[model samples]
Target: MTSNFLIFDCDGVLADTERDGHLPAFNETFEHFGAPIRWSQDDYAELLRIGGGKERLASVLTPELVKEAGLPTDPRQQRDVVLSWHAYKTARYTDMVRAGRLPGRPGVARIVAEAHDAGWGLAVASTSAEESVRAVLEHVVGPELSTHFSVFAGDDVAAKKPAPDIYQLALAQLGASSTSAIVIEDSHVGLTAALAAGLVTVVTQSSYTADEDFSGAALVVSSLGDYPADPTVVLDSPHGTAIVGHVGIDDLIRVRAAALSANSTPGR
Candidate 1:
């Protein structure tokens, strides 16, 4: 069966916005609030395991960091502080998008144009804030493609990636069944979310997520594709070759075909 909708996770998949975009925005927010918490690339690479911004912050807060930062030791107050920081970080992240500091991932424009022309429904389901996601989408696909997408993002639901709530919401809102949707992700968390929702997923490893596991993805790749200026390079792996450029509808159709075939076979 062919996937009727292509679902995207924003941060690493649509844009290589983490190092140049998100990390600096987060540090700027921490500075503005006079907080001692500043996440370096190395620090955030570890935190990426946690899935949500506020959740990641909560994970690292110890009695010592709280005391040193003059934060309340109580769990509720800690939650509030993390939420406040995330709100500020989101604003700064959006500001960076507005300033054009972040560029969409290579081949994003080409693939989106191809999909749009083929009449495929497009949507972005991400843990990132809606404003930030929409900004990046606009930058990548222009206003027309941006407007065509149904966005389900931050805080609209109770749980983040690896929980399937966001993807579930996107599927419901878009009236797409799991079998009829394909998700594009960069992290294991996002991959887990899509798989749990019973949708096939494709992974494009980003800098922060390259070493993470992607056992269940239908396809795992280095990037979507390279353009004229940038050559496409596929990574060889023990499992298979990682897709890189101009991966078309037929490629995705093959993935679904393989998945269906694998499922229908009797036990050995």
Candidate 2:
């Protein structure tokens, strides 16, 4: 018997964690460490383009800021500093998650339940730290559902989203070709990575990624849509797969089929 896999991105895709969960944690960590910077909503929105919390922090390491923060000028020593800050940030982020400060995004729990019932493989592919990802996953789907997830996050791959390393690693870990996997991503960066790995993808535009380009996605929706309460809105379907209801296992299967058909066709 053949198997299909559903891989999710943690931050914005699982829940709207970027704005509510991570952003504040970063600011709080900055305050605690007496760092000279705090990422406002606008600043963090731009930072989301870069994958990984450590990379986000590393990106803004200017000589002036380093000096202000008393950070080491040596590359390796500087890395140690960032690592400590990231560890603290992860703690704060998890605390917020444990506190139930963020709600699961529409359709996540419902689709996860549907997928589980159908015997689909489940996993989370993310640029966040593993602890942080696990915390959010548990909050989104509860402990029972989260246990089904195989998480690939943080340094699981040398490179992050927009580079394809993480998604490629996921496919390799499954020992399966990209044909058997589908990725659900919220950011263009994550979408690019999935496409680069030759995986089918659906985009659920999140708070920070709503205005970004998602030209290659097989399907794009506002959310997975929990029937009766939150309806899924189709934003774009490049392959023209019909999404009549909340995106479920059946809809994802159709999207994957349509993508395979399109790719197999000649003369583009």
Candidate 3:
């Protein structure tokens, strides 16, 4: 049996972890390992284009860094070295999450609770490491709601986003149809992946993803909006669904409903 699904992307969507948590963790890992590779905010903004953290680390391996960091020169050995760095970084980042250094995005907790109570299939589909994603999910939505989520992350699929493999795997595991799932994503690559998998996506722009394209998202908001504290502002809404202070499960259903109707109409 299939159920309606609400899938979330871990990093930016669940919490604004990329800037405060991940970036610092990566730097700290490099420092702890004596690697001279340190990325500034602007550098990470560009690096965000890459999908997986391992890939991102691989992308920055320079001859100078290899020698200075005492990394193995052999290709296979260097791959192992990069893997170790990523593992360490994941640990550091998860620690930050467990310590509550990163705050959950505005309405993420509220929406998660509401969706769970409504019996919507909930999952997190991300390219981040499983433990890292789990840590952030638990920290943001709490240990109680986190238990209800199915997490599909890291090498769960060979291809990462901007590729649909992760989302496709999630759909299969969740026993959900494309029209029955709504994805909350915070980056252009994440949005592209969810769209390619035929799921309706909503973009809640993060610190690093505000200017990226989100033309296909059913809704694009500043944050999910937590009532009076942080009201979500619609950046782009393809379905034109009205959002009050925050987005709830009802808004998600309406968005998916509108998406289905549009796709079902003639000439669409």
Candidate 4:
């Protein structure tokens, strides 16, 4: 079926949350905790491959790092430290959101209003905390449109992106089937998760994800754009031809219709 639901991946897809918002927040958290740890840009870029904030924090706990940072040795204490760090990071990120530091991507607010008015089910699925997601959504689309989004984030599922758990949870909670929904994602992992759930996906490049492979995306663009001031440059498309510049809500509908048509075809 043509997509009646639109699911958004937070962070990169909604706003450029990773570089400006999240990175600083993480650094601030590390400083506040008196940990001799600070992830340089390159270091954090590698860490983004991990799913959640706590997961990312835990991933840095090698024996050397643990010793250098003087982190708790006990497993329980280690887990607690990561949790506390994540909580502080989340708060800092939310503060950044509230401060209007992260602006919505080119067409995010426009497309969201369009989708909401067209009666599409709107939602955000992410590994970030629900509070952080809400803050970013509200900051981007304002309180009214933000309310229309059903958020599935943080520890909402046992597994994170690339595992299909978060997208599956979103589909279930939105009362929609994967075939009836389209997901907008920025990272390869996010695209894989959505695709694994059987949803069509559109990729808009983000800071850290631009060079990553996005082999299965139905459409790939620099950003979901509004044209003129921030026109979108098509990076890839279903057919091997040059695509027109700038993508709006109508382009999304065409993409969804094309996906539905393809899915209905018989295959081996």
Best by TM-score: 2
How many residue pairs clash per model?
Answer: 3, 0, 0, 0
Q: State the lDDT of candidate 4 residue by residue for 1-268, as single tens digits.
A: 3248889999999999999999999999989988888888899888888898889999888899889878889999999989988989999999999999999988899989988888889999999999999999999999999998999999999898888999998888778987778899999889989889988899999999989999878889999887688888888887332345566567787887777677677991
Cα deviation at 123, candidate 2, in Å, is 0.6
Tell me the tens digit of each residue's lDDT in model 2 across 1-268: 3388899999888999999999999999999988889888899989988888999988878999988878889999888988998999999999999999999999999999988888888999998999999999999999999999889999998888899999888888876679998999998899999999999999999999999999889999999998778889999988888787689899999999999899889987
CA lDDT of every candidate = 0.80, 0.91, 0.91, 0.88
The C-alpha local distance difference test score for the whole of candidate 3 amounts to: 0.91
lDDT of 1 by residue, 75-174 (tens): 8888898889888888888888878888888777877888788888999998888888999999877888899888999888888888999999998888
Candidate 1 residue pairs in backbone clash = 224-244, 225-244, 225-245
User: What TM-score would you give candidate 4 relative to the actual structure?
Assistant: 0.95
Q: In model 2, what is the error at residue 236, expressed in angstroms?
A: 0.5
Quote the positional error of residue 265 for candidate 2 in Å.
Answer: 1.0
Candidate 3 vs. truth: CA RMSD? 1.3
Candidate 3: stretches off by over 4 Å: 67-70
